[model samples]
Target: MSSSYQALKPARPDLDSAGLPYSPDYGDIYHAAQGSLAQARHVFLAGNSLPGRWAGRERFVVCETGFGLGGNFLALWQAWRADPSRCRRLHVVSLEAHPFTREGLLAMWRASLAPELQDLAAQLHAQWPDPLPGLHRLEFEGGALTLTLGFGQALELAPRLEARVDAYFFDGFSPARNPEMWSPHLFRRLARMAAPDATLATWCSAGHVRRAMEDAGFLVERKPGLHGKRHMVAGVRRTLRTPGKARLPQAHGGPRTALVIGGGPAGAGMAHALALRGWQVTVVDPMAVRDGGVHQGHTAAACVPLIARDDNPRARLARAGNLRTWARWSALAGDAAPLRCGALQMQRLEGRAGDPRDALAALDFPADWVRWMEQDEASECAGLHLSQGGVYFASGMLVRPPQLLGALLAFPGIRHVQASVAALRHGTDGWQAQDAAGQVLAVGAVLIMTSAVASWPLLQQTGLPADAAPRLATVQATGGAIASWPSGRLAGGPSCVLGAEGYVLPALAGRCVLGSTYEEDKTTWTQTARRLAIAEKMPAMLADAGLATTDGAEDWWGGDWAGWRALVPGRLPVLGPVPQLPDAWVATAFGSRGFSWAALAGDVVAASLEGEPLPLERDLLEAIRP
Candidate 1:
């Protein structure tokens, strides 16, 4: 693999006379002439002895060198679904140097003659990501099935991946066409990633490839080929007669029950993730169960992605989190779904030195994801007068927090307990939560701290040493308030959420939400002053849109004010396992970006706990690790 990140150069397949996908670059066909599905089962599934090998297993992982059209993955998923004794969780990690575009994939599926294959292909295409570098995780079958698509060279990506793969599919182009993929170094990396007794199979039965596998400690065998081919190859990791360097640690089995200590976005998100994996989760919060948990009273909030000039960790995490959140919410019903109106983030001309739009333009992101809009275009998109142009996220959402939280906690396996956790202790059985009087509130195999600033005090009560975690001291609680005005007061507000120094949401439930004021020294902001401050940020836009008059803050004052606590230190959230506590994890410090960070952060935690392929790259995970 290349040493540095290489953006995917998607493949364009041409149809042969027989309507089969023929790759011009490789000068070869994608699958056997018999059929793609038939070849997949024969060369990969049966070669690895799957469905039988994975039967009754708690989790099974398969790593593949090529993901052309995703035929093998879909075939395996369909088979797993049909099997009564299939593994509870199926993870497929496939590295593709040249992935096909969504359209290309759809075209291939259309040419296919199989109905079941077409149906599965449609599902894969719908979730296909923009051919971005690094890893992109797509979940299916309610999270029971996961596909980790590595859009990079296999040599670099294989070492980066952390999985105890039970099976391997070496299905890249033929050795004659792609010698780099059949290198000995690649086989050695696969051996390092394989679990003990791991099996491997491939349609390529070249002598050199067999020798490479044998040199890498795999017991190799040549088998009869499918579709009248000459021969195929299958292998298993052979136990070494001599001891090598210490092998990588195997993934531990995650607990069946989890105790989530919050009902806010983070807690609810974690609960939903664990519940999807068949874990029984209990969420405890001081507040009563309501439509939106902690954000119940807020009329509206912006669920928009953030962009930085360099696409830093926070920016990347925000993008991943926003996408995951959208997918999760889109699957829900009733009030759980967010209003799909887009959001406009206006350019700041006050103190900032450079324009963000210029940096964004250089990135060449997809227009459907985000686009630079001039002042006139911005106004046209918002249906309100605007003084400046900024970035517009086409898929931005105006979400009601409570509604989303309620839906996340509504999973059948999730149970909510209305109580404040006064203490946390690790006993022989597992972790336990207690109230102030020392009465046990809940007990579970794992504990997730998502109570924001309150989590520090609770962590201190765990009786661990002071050095166990020093980073918790850096967390600071800041006060914030969102003021709302009667929708009728403003003749017409922006069509969607308008964000600049402060944010203004379009009318929801007869009111427009104008947020917010951040005060570190004071717990509450003067409603009049806070409203005036927000109104001052976009005075011209508000006046032009009939939201305010020349009298300055007078028209926007005297509205309702809602306050909440935001915890922040480095802006990035603190996630992953807590220090000195094996089963305890922290998912806090979300600050004002809770809506943007919740879903992805929850996924990170879930992946860590369940030993599944991570949704993020290693660098990003380390950046946010607690």
Candidate 2:
């Protein structure tokens, strides 16, 4: 399947005299006039025997075909919140071809009689995704509730979803109006995704729909309809036959403790991902501080997505990682959140064949994802003068690494241990991490080495053949430094991040970050060289922004310069398990792309441990496998 997503242009809904939402395209009311919330409880919640069915379960997943006005989701969320015996985690996956705009949803919610649902409706409105044709996962209530909204045609989306649905809310427009949603192909796809004894509830009891369900191995039965409807259908998957093809890998069902040997982006990301899945994760780093020591001194970093002519694995992984990072960080509150002001990749030379804009145009990506801008347009967007125009990423973020790390480690069940792991030992139970003093720092069911190049030495100390993974031998620790200019030094810095050979972030806290010069042999960086390097590119970027550099600007480097080491080889991170060790994984070699790769790589680690669906395709996973 194509990874690109298109934005949906939804037709506005018209309300009847009773204020019931009516769909002009489908020629059907969104819900019964009796009351949408009431209809949801009777036709969906009670039809599938939910609340009671989900009781005491570790996690329960519910799939809905239509999410008109999000009434069903809100009602279900309310029920889960009220039930004392509700499942520990509630995952609601809903598909909608024409999702309502935020204003539309809010207006519908305001017209409702149930005041209890208003608050939940507001929350949903706040978290509503960009109507992009892909699965958008939004988490709420501290990860207790997750809503995976698939914005696209049901036929195209249902088959791509990786979910083990326990119950289904099959509420679509009348089968006569939108037959594709109730087709045999969709039914069979649903069957393939259903878990054993999966139950489905639908208000439409059309004979053809019932027959399709039966043919797909569901035992269907007519039931009392909600409101004044003549009939509704409820069915459960029959276990007599095979449970269809497996949806995805099952969870490991092993111990839920993990030890991550780094406190940088990769380790913090892994800890956060695992913690969200109810794992207790401990991150060890000798330099870690409670107040964001990991990224101290560095005020800002660019979080731009990469573009490639071929859209190779590196580009694909970077794109996926960028999206995941945005979602994960946007859900965070306070200073931990990243600034979402877009970023610009300035064109280096005239008519460059490898320009990102040409590649993006060839790919025909959604405008919201990326768009080409001329120098004039780029200047207008950045609120500055510019030398060249290139591609603009609307979702690019400006993240303070330390703040982000602090936020990732702040999640409950994530402990930050201040110690250096000198060695690792894998035994029958799991893996043990020891400090230089031979003190056991942590023992976990799984071990993730995120210490960058330092991990190779630790692996060698554990008697694990580091050479077993030939790629490990190529890992090199390269050092780099980022210099900054005081905000006053430049005549109003660019409004957003600007990238060419080197990148500059919009001024943050009185300083504009610049110059990330990489050197293989140098562990330290001088202010003079870093300043000159930044100055060389500043004129081109500033000239377009209509800003002129003043005398001595090249020597006026701010105090925000700092050096750090990044592991690299092929510029692709080494992820997944070690070649010969089970339950031991490595997430390193991210190099400068740590922010761009951390979230997705961390999810891969968490998914592998949980035996859950991988966030990446198998081929892409193999490209970075350790």
Candidate 3:
């Protein structure tokens, strides 16, 4: 049945006079209302027996129905952070139909939670997106914890999402008050996204809700509810096999091997995907250490598409790249390294109806999942000023590039060696890559998944300016930079990944990061005045997003800010097999779009090496070339 008839609002125990969300002051509510926070802990946390249930797993995911004030998430983060044996990573995904303003969230967090959760609270507030329908992802603590806020009707949003949750927090106000949340369809969708052993806890034990859970293949039961309430409902998910559970074939070539250079998202993703296919993979980098590496050798980046939404080459590649990269990254990092927090791109705050942002919003993708927002809603979500609205990617994320690389490199078939390969030569038997010391680092079929460094004249002989192949499109590099600041005061950051000119991460390690500048290939990573000029323009891009530059902000080294390039004419990255080189392949020209394209690129390369069907068309693959 359609969920269009759900109630817009019902009397909530936590709200005060004039419908302002508030509750009776308790110990945790001294600075704010305690109803929502206390109820969440009792119904969602204690009911699920969290911290104790997720003790042994490598990763754990929890899905909730509401993320109001983020009190529940803060408590969970705090609990997970405090637990010595907590899973290596914790993922929290929540859905909300109407989100609060960033300032309101901060005020509530400050009033309710203890000082310890304040840092995380502030970070959440800082990156909160505009109230556009979709998802927003946030990362914290070196990619150990992730928060995905789904903005839209839970019924409409739940089914569109993918990911396995270890626990469920049925946290919408009340079934009687908010009946839409207690629908059978949502329960079934929840079961679908849950693993066999998934557990759930909810404050309401209403007969209708309990029946729906049971109908949705959950082993529902009743327990004591909070605040002297009569009962609560809890359950475990039932398992159903997906269409294909078959095993994948191993690579046939003798001791199949892939060589990944340049140690960034592309290299890391390539290594990881190949390893999964049982291909022996080795990654070489010039500066990264084999152990105790500084800066972790990677940073988080995005996979956003250009504003225009059409069937052009860039749009198609962006769409394909977005889907492929998102799937692989989600599989590896799940809720840890990144959260599929959808994205929003606005034009001017006061833009007209026919604005670019509005046009993008009209794409026939998923109306309920992503739609245009009015200026007020945009202003509310971003906690800043806004002009015209923009498009929202229901499926988007902000990922820790290094953390993902670390996971990708951790695959069993992959090995890490510290050395720089100066050149490559192919013999009658096979191919050999030589390091500066002239020692043979590798001998087998090699794929040069390195950045532009390998595109230099040294390896230009393999195939060059003459045989660069006919280009379906041309692209140029644009310099970009990301700066960071401690977000100690913000609250309830965006519910989705929000980008305009440059983007801002919700917060990592209590610090928020904003980026970047797209410059013509200048070939320097330095953060120069020109780069900062682009960086400083974020305020205007997010005019409705009320963020001010921090004092003494940490100037992250935006390496060589010169080489930051994005393919011009068409903004898509060049991917797939190298046309000329038989034993070699190249995955380059992924300028600012690397984060969104690399995962998919890695998958496509792995498929190509394994002789599997690629996910893209041949013409599209051959579109981006030298």
Per-residue lDDT of 1-626 in model 1, one digit per residue for the tens?
Answer: 12353445678868778888888888877888887789889999999998899998878989998898787898898899899999998999999988877777788878873687777777788999876556788888877899999887888776667666789999977898989889998888767767787999999988999999888888999999996788999998887421233233344464688989988888888898888767888899988645676676766788888776666677777877777777766778876787878888875547665677665665556676788888898988888777777789877888877788888898889998899888888887688889989999898888899888888788887765656655664678777778776666665667878888788788877778887877865545676666666666656355364555526545544445454555655688888778877788888888887877787788777777777877776677667666
What C-alpha lDDT values do all the predictions have? 0.78, 0.78, 0.61
> What is the overall TM-score of model 1 with all chains considered together?
0.90
Q: On residues 116-205, what C-alpha lDDT tens digit does candidate 3 reach at each position?
A: 667877777766755544455555775467676766688776665656667888866565556788888788776676666778888778
User: What are the root-mean-square deviations of the candidates from the true structure over C-alphas?
Assistant: 3.3, 4.2, 13.4
Per-residue CA lDDT of candidate 2, range 479-577, in tens?
677878776666567788888767778888788888677776664556666666566666657673334454566555775455556665567888878
TM-score of each predicted structure versus truth: 0.90, 0.84, 0.54
- Flag the better candidate by TM-score, 2 or 3: 2
Candidate 3 has a TM-score of 0.54
